[model samples]
Target: MFRWDGGPVAGGFAPAPAADALRQWRSPDGGLWLAAWGAEHRGTYTGWCVDAEAGLVLVADASLYDRDGLQSALGLAGPVLDAPTLLLRGYQRWGEGLPQRLDGDFAFVVCDLRKRCVFAASDPMGMRPLFHRLLPGGGFAFATAPEALAACTGLDARIPESRLLEPLFNAEQLAHFEPEITGIQRLLAAQWLRADARDVQVQRYWTPGQTRPALASTDVDGWVEALRWHLGEAVRKRLADGVRAGVMFSGGLDSSAVLALGCGYVPAGRLQAYSVLDRGNPACPETRAIDRVLAATGVPATCIDVADMQEQAAGALDALAASPRFVSGRNGFLPLFDRMAAASGVDVMMNGIDADALFFYEDLLERQIRAGGYAVALRCARKQDRMAGEAWMVPLVRRLRYTAHLPPVVRNGVRRWRGRASEWPRLHAALLRTDACEALGLRARARRHLALLRRPPPPAGGLPTQTLHGAVNLDGIGRFHARSRHFGVEMRCPFLDRALIDFAAWIPLELRLRNGHLKWILRKAMTPHLPHAVAWRGDKFHPGSHFDRVMLQPVLEQVVRDFHGSGPAIGRWIDRGRFLAAAQRWQAGQIEAVWELKMLLLLEHWLQHNADKVAFGR
Candidate 1:
């Protein structure tokens, strides 16, 4: 936090953040204040740094996976330095271009005394978050989380109703498109911000869509070898020597592979697996998958049977909802991580969130048919169907029905013959109140927003954006961030490693989209050593399949009956009667309104808890 001295609409001032960050520092005149929080992990910032001779004061929330590579690039000799020191020296050496040369998740601010400007940047993947507010005369303040920035002394943190409701316009498009959903400016992935007396500017520094790695021409076997090597290295470098790490073992291909790879780097007791098994759904597919993995690997594992924990977690809901930094995750699981941290001392967690986004499943089979590669498409589909225990003819016929050359009349006939789920726009629209959506134009805006995903994603993606979660473009969905923030534990995702992503980018489209499977190359590379059937399996059993029955029906009933059309913010976009009807329908085991209900519930909690204390402008 910082306050401009003698700038427009400003005087002598000091801006204080609300939360107790790990470290806080202030310049003599109180014109600048720096605060940071970091976990005990490689590339973490322990404290703020000031180089009077170099004319720089730096505060960073960073984790550089390739500190050795960065040090080598900067020509820094002598003993290894920390991430913050490396960032400071890199800024001196390469200036703003330093972000391009660096790898890993980072968000940092450098107050450059020589230039009289402050520079900030987040890593290419946005593994860390950065939010800021810019006032008149280029006076600025920023924090790692939006709520933190809102809490600082300098700005009107009261979010406007219009801004508060903007997210509903494209709630289906989950990440990045409207990162400012909380009504604060977010520095996007690969973006840099520069603020000075003259002006404040935000510019994107790297375009992942345009990045082309050099390994594109390698043969299939060579590509597989390269992927295995990169995957191993990605896991190895991120663990950091002597740092205890664990994986959220879901018994899925990605997490299972991470566990297999991680075992090579750490000892038996050092690496652990944490899983959430729903006691109610004991016979679910994931349970079977988990059984297979446990039978095969025999790795030490702890299962958090959450079907019984609702009563225990009940008291924390009000407090969790009351926080201004409202996170979008299973807050119900917060205690499980705390237990993991307390009992097991596992400080770092490796996640497999990026696999779905990076090793994308493509629509090339349909394209192959259109482009006259029928044999190739059939072969791939056959292999995929065999592995999935489905008949090979299903996808072949479906592909034929969906091919572009099929007339609309024929496609309509096929659709009538075999029912298909509605598109995301229609499905997501059902969640909002009809009157609220029309009045606020969310009905139209949501369609327009979702239509953008109809186009093909860049090479660095997992599924068709047309599919659900196509919006999950290698982004961490606050599960890790929420847990880390709540517990002060370090978290890392080897799959989000820049080098791994780059290696995945260069994989030939044939292998990437082959076998009619999502992340075919990744599975092919890992199956040899993954030890479990999950690597060869295509079905990913989502834990939320039973969430409506287990979680929502009981808890959300009160939220629906209790809420009237009264919130200063929610009522404008969510009609009380209509939203109540939707919630009622949802509680009756209907899932059409899941996203809208969940998001509105989150916002209602935010508004109810924060409206008075948030200091809204009169």
Candidate 2:
């Protein structure tokens, strides 16, 4: 609710008539303060500092200051400062000077008034989000929500067509919209944007370290020890600041590892854990297994019964769709987390989202290809030519099925590949249309193309054949972060730490998957801390069970019907008859590709809603 319009006049901005009642808004002597109702129990707080003399403005999330001493440190300036201080905790940093030194789940903007310039950046992993819009008067405005920016400026609110198609056809585009709204754009992960009257420039402050240093012949033990140390450090850093921190524990290896690492840092009763489950879900046993681990670890944990929260599902989806990102119907489980986080008054929610992708890339690809090859080989052996005409269909069907059974590593790889791969054709076509490819800065495009050209080598060991599994995990992480931010809740994935990822990248495939087990190295390292039952759990619990349950709620049916009637963009590519048939099949308990198809349908609806917001012109 904190509002400010520094357009050379006081109280010039329009009033927030629809602002939530729990909101607090203030523009302090040199800064702006806004707090609003967040998630279910917790509230979100943000602050912005405007230094008129130096022309620098600093904005940040309020929850990031439990231990950084940033508040007190910045408070020393007492309303005015000799220079400018834009310090953010729990966010990614950009640029060389003040930006590179900062880290955590965050994104912020700084306006240098003296230089007539503005700058903004997002976290390295793109966990947090910040979006900007160029106003009709040649000035710009930024906000945490697309709705806020659109409401504040004279901008259109209609959804885009690509928003729908992107998620259905190219799932990774769910991270941010295409065409980026003519005068609006999102700060890319690990990138910074600076704008002045003279010019505007955006630059990447971080990049994945692909050139891995070779592992010394005798450094195997040392490498393991280092990996453990870095993992532990990442967990500990997240636990700092004395703020109430909780884990999205599934009793799986990754979450268990996070819980174990955090156990040493958080006090006995202070550590809270949350899980979601459907009473009749087949994965209930796994949730129970996770309960056993949490009980043994002595951390307080809660398993939210999502089946009871039927009415809240639609509202959750609406909130998620308000952002520029794609809303996968799969995230119906997120509302439970949001409600629990709000009710528990917990601020920081740690998740094990990226562990599988970072560590199990090899295993994922092996599984996919193995499954794909098996299907291919089976068909060949049977002399079944039915698959010949639908070459893409075979892999697509196999890939979708493989997703449900994928280990964390393979899941992550598929999400990443799918996101990047879907963009390949479009990027190529765009480049072909434009003669100034070099002038447009297509280096990232080139890198993606090269990666696609490098055909995945055959698995040397007993690994999965699916090379695209990791991409799936990556997309999930991206979607999770974007949606979490939408509700004002911060979900941090410790295993996705840049340091841990870089180190894991160098780990040879042989060690990643051995003896047909996924994440073997991590499992081995966690043996001393995690119970054997938790450490060696063979099957990954399907979080989608609760999602499926929510999908059956009558409200969701109404939502789907309403979206269809609203002329949703998804209606363009979706065969309404096919979608309706799939929905009926899902309702009859014959859910398979129907759920995925529904997700595509919802994505298309979202795209149609935001069609005009894409910024292709800029």
What candidate 2 gets wrong by more than 4 Å, as runs, is 1-45, 50-55, 62-95, 134-137, 170-180, 210-218, 278-285, 304-329, 362-478, 553-576, 593-597, 600-618
lDDT of 1 at 376: 69
lDDT of 2 at 42: 32
lDDT, candidate 2, 1-618, per-residue tens:
112333431223433445534444443342233333333313223556554554445675423322334434444434422112435321213333444445456677765544555667766666666777655445556776655666556565445433323333333443353323445677766778877555668887765443455566246576667678878878877767565777877777888899878888977777788776556664565666676677778887776555565555555455445654555336555645654574576767787877766676534434444445444333332322241223433454345455545565776576666666655454433212223333333435444433533434444443223332234553465567656555545677788676666567666554565444567678778878888877866655555555544643453365468556863444433445555666666677664644445555445434545556554322
The most accurate candidate by lDDT is: 1
Off by over 4 Å in 1: 1-22, 28-30, 37-43, 158-183, 199-203, 209-218, 278-283, 306-344, 361-375, 378-431, 438-441, 444-448, 451-471, 474-483, 559-618
List of clashing residue pairs for candidate 1 = 360-462, 361-462
Q: lDDT of each model, Cα atoms only? A: 0.62, 0.55
lDDT of 1 by residue, 458-577 (tens): 222332222212444523444356446455556777876777776675566567657667577888899777754677776655554244234444445656556643343555455567
Write down the TM-score for model 1: 0.78
